[model samples]
Target: MQICVIGCGYVGLVTAVCFAEMGNSVTCIDSNVERISMLQEGRSPIFEPGIEVLLSSNIRGGRLCFSATLDDGALRGAEVVFIAVGTPSAEDGSADISQILSVANELAHKLTQPAIVVCKSTAPVGTACRVQNILDQHCASLQRIGLHRVVSNPEFLKEGAALNDFMRPDRIVIGTDDNQAQQVMHQLYEPFVRNHDRILFMSRRAAEMTKYAANAFLATKISFINEMAAFCDEFAVDVEQVRKGIGADQRIGHHFIYAGCGYGGSCFPKDIRAILHMAGEHNRRMPILEAVEARNQEQKTWPFRALQDQLGEDLSGLTVTIWGLSFKPGTDDIRDAPSRTLIESLLIAGAQIKAFDPIAADNIKRCYPHAVKTGQLQLVDEPYDALQGADALVLVTEWKQFRQPNFSLMRSLMRNPLLLDGRNQYEPALVEREGFVYVGVGRPSTQPVAAALRAVV
Candidate 1:
């Protein structure tokens, strides 16, 4: 199959490279010249695990290529065109699908042959229909006889495990009323789902809704556990034990059950907002989702609030070490990351921050240039280097390296041995046994009453 993938961001680039690996000729198109050039040189613009290797291998095999525009020869004679652009949350909370619409309009003029345009981006329901309408109007204007087929084929790739997710998808969703479009999509994805017939053919609107519903439900699980964690705190109960207790029921298998700082990335937050906006447009209210969003907003501040409960409300001149900066481990994406909330709050209170992440330190530094220039924020190379002379340490993202550390060494390096476990990665008793005062979200504070009261007030 000759495939053209538009908007070579995370989804588009991964989709193109994986298809090429499966013996399909793929041309990935993006407007960003620098990104396209990097891809053409066998470098991935984004830091996804093993993507650069796949991109290089596919390009060397003459199965994959990159281009800056759809006007180029990329879309010519393409069997399927993927609109994998970003559908970021707008200021009004709806998905800003201008990118998808723009691509549809561009394809209307550029496509030399009728092709299936797959909506690979996660958009609100009926977005594919809108794309179809745009293409139809363009076809009528051009005096073309046939209307282009549009399919809602939302991607379900995870950030860190994107390559694996694409190569072995749990299910392949093809949303189209057109039999030809459905058949082509199934055939294109047949290789990935060869072991089992996991292709689910459905209506376009249902497919779009499935994407949002899936993310929203996962987000709700995170929020639900966090809420339970908070409730357990009043009685000094370990949420970990309760999590295990509930997870053993088989009906509630553990997936997104970790009571972390919050859920953040390109998907959960944005998709939840988009779905809420869609509900509002139809005069419907989703109160459960509303509370879920509210809890997550409050949860992201757990680390900073915990820091204040250990140190004073005014964090002036305090040195804090942060273990992770990305939204989650396995990628460098920091969009709406809980680490940002803690960093901003600490900085605002006049605290000096020393942050370290194996891959995301540079991206975090780029986000705070003025702070970096003023020496207020330090992005360190070594994780222990971040702890040097620090008053407190907060584990934000649970990177693999931060799992087990020399707590004795950490205690000796810090000015004050205050540990705030944002992701509940450390056992409070074990951390306290290392001669450090430990604070964790929804966990009992180990500080002395007077000290704890002073820090909390």
Candidate 2:
């Protein structure tokens, strides 16, 4: 299939690369010249694991290409066009899909022949219909009505594992009332779902709603577990045990049940907000989702609150080490990350900070230029470098490298060996036995080494 994917961001770029790897000729378009140049040189502007290699291989294999703009008839001879632009949240929590609309209008004028336009970006209901109307109106002006077809094919790719997710999707959703459009979209995706007939045909609106519902539910699970963790804290119970007890049930098999700082990336927060805005527009209230959103906002501050509990309300004269800066472990995306909330709070409280992330340190440095310039916040090159003279170490994003370390070395490096495990990745008793004070999300804080050993016995 001849594919044209616009907006070479995370989703679009991954889709183009994966499709090209599957032997389809793909042309990815982006407005930024620098980004297009980088892609043309076989370099990925984004940081997704295993994507750069696939992208380079596909480019060398003559199956993938990049363009800076839609000029020179970029959509010509394209069997399928994917609109994968960003739909950021407006002030009122509604999705600002002006970019999608603008691309639709551009296609209406620039597309030489009528083709299937897939809305790969998640949007509100009727967005695909709106694009269809635009294309149809343009065709009517040219005396070729009903020549184009639009499909709502929302992508379900995660950030770090995007290549795998795209190559082996759990289900392929094609939203179009037109049988021809559905067939073409399915045929385009047939290679990925060859082992099973995983194509789910539905209305365009239903497809859009499915993506929102899926992410919202995952976010709800995270918030629900965090709430349970908080409740267990009040009762001196370990949320880990409670999580295990509930997760053992076949129905609630643990996916997002681990209590953590919060979930922050491109999808969960934005999708939840869009759902709430949609409910409000229809005069409906979603109290459960509202609480989920509220709980997550408060959860992002868990590290700071825990620090306050240990170091008191005023964090002045403190040196804190942060192990992770990205939103999650596998990617360099820091949008709305919990680390931001903690760093901001610590900055205001006059605490000196040292943070280290294997991939996201540069991005975090850009976000806090003044602090770096003034030496209040130091983005260290290594994990242990950040621990020198540190008062407390907070493990935020649970990267693989931070899993096992020389505890004795860490104990010697820091002035005070306070360990706050944000993701509950550590056994408190074991960490306590390492001669450090251990604090976990919902696990009991372990006492000194001798006391912890006695308690374990």
Worst 10 residues of 1 by lDDT: 446-455
Candidate 2 global Cα RMSD: 2.8
Judging by lDDT against the true structure, name the best candidate: 2
RMSD (Cα, Å) of candidate 1?
A: 2.6
For model 1, the superposed segments whose C-alpha errors exceed 4 Å read 446-457
List clash counts for every candidate, in order: 0, 0
Q: Per-candidate TM vs. native? A: 0.97, 0.97
Predictions in order: lDDT: 0.90, 0.92
